[model samples]
Target: MIAVVYSGSHYAHWRLADRGKTVASFRTSGINPYFNDEKQITTLLNKNINLIHHAEQIKRIYFFGPGLASNELKDIIRNAFLTFFKFAKITVAHDIDAVAIASCKNTEGIVCICGSGTNAAWYDGKK
Candidate 1:
């Protein structure tokens, strides 16, 4: 199973999929590393029934959010997920990276984001 998450300052959107079919989709409180610690993040995860039920079954996770501008910030979320998702290969990246991938996929394209903040980037199919 694979999980994809996109978080802003106010909410986190989650999608769990397996065999190219969606298993579940839901939302939780936002997970901004700058505003939340590892324990807080883990706590949020623990409260969600969807996550609790699927945690052990998920094999991969892709998380995107703001405030992951540095490796240190990314580690905050990574560490929290690590504690909860013991068997998954987790990836943490900037929310803009998500914009890139969504707009370009495996092709070259430019993406512009304008929500709470504004920025643009060029994706060469591989970041």
Candidate 2:
């Protein structure tokens, strides 16, 4: 099975699973004051750790989020995931790109996601 995880200013964490022809998904509220702060970041990490713990069948994990501009934060998140899910293969994808791909032919006109953060992309019929 494969697991896809993501977090952003608006969401603390989210997970999706692909199992043969079935798919499962869920989302959690973002820790308060979502940002680069230590407390909030730790909370987010804890949330991810919990999710990873329950997904024992997940062989791979794909993370989608904005690339951290701060190397310190990047290292922190990387180490946390490694410590929590040592066996899972992890990959990161740009948040905008994920949104664009997911929105393909699903909605008419512009597809936008907005909250504490925002993402917008045009979804034409052609792939």
Candidate 3:
């Protein structure tokens, strides 16, 4: 089983799959490690009743969301995932990097994150 999630500032969407077939879909409020504490993130994640019921069934999870810019933030988000999905292998990433990597793949191009926290990178497609 696997799970994938994408989150922006306002919302997060979750999809769960088994043997490449989608089995469940759910949504929860955006969980930004920069803005939410453990308790708040836990509460928000609980809003998705399906996730709660199927947490243990998921073997892996890929979550992309805003505000995951530091190790502290990653730790915070990881803690939140561990709190609920006790058995899944979880990967949390910044939303922009998720989009960039998905779109570019092994092709070389520029990847940038603008707005309040602006960053730019040149990619050889390896790093």
Candidate 4:
């Protein structure tokens, strides 16, 4: 099982999949470690316990958010997921990395992201 998430300033969307097919999806407040604290992010996730049920089945999680600008922030988000999806392997990264990976995979190429803001990069396929 796998989980994928994309977060912006306003919302964070997540989807759980099994064998490449989507099984469940949920949304919580944007778990941006920049503006919102761990308590707030926890509140958002707790608000939807049903979502956590699906999260439990996930073995891997790829979380991307615009606010993950530092390792400290990444740790915050990672810890939040750990609170619920206790056994899942979680990977948190900036939204820009999400954009680049989504478009180019592990190949060298140029990628551009135009979400709430704009960014462009030459990705060597790594985030």
TM-score of 1: 0.96
lDDT of 3 by residue, 7-119 (tens): 77667888899998999887777778777898898887777778878888988989888888788888888898889889989898887766678767888888886644566
- Positional deviation of 101 in candidate 4, in angstroms? 1.4
Task: Give the alpha carbon lDDT tens digit for every residue of 26-126 in model 4.
Answer: 77667778788777777787788656577567789899997776899898989888887777998998888888887888988888777776778789977
Q: Which scores better on TM-score, 1 or 4?
A: 1
The Cα local distance difference test for each model comes to 0.95, 0.57, 0.81, 0.81
Model 2: lDDT equals 0.57
Distance from true location, Cα of 65 in model 4, Å: 0.6
Q: By the lDDT metric, which is better: model 1 or model 3?
A: 1
Taking all chains together, the TM-score of candidate 4 against the true structure is 0.88
Query: Lowest-scoring 10 consecutive residues by lDDT in candidate 4?
Result: 49-58
In the range 28-97, model 2's lDDT, one tens digit per residue, is 6542322445454545556654464555656687766664545665554555555555566766554655
* TM-score of each prediction: 0.96, 0.57, 0.85, 0.88
Cα shift from native, residue 123, model 2 (Å): 9.6
Measured by TM-score, how close is model 3 to the native structure? 0.85
lDDT, residue 18, candidate 4:
91
**Would you give me the overall lDDT of model 4?**
0.81
- In Å, residue 51's CA in model 3 sits off its true spot by 0.2
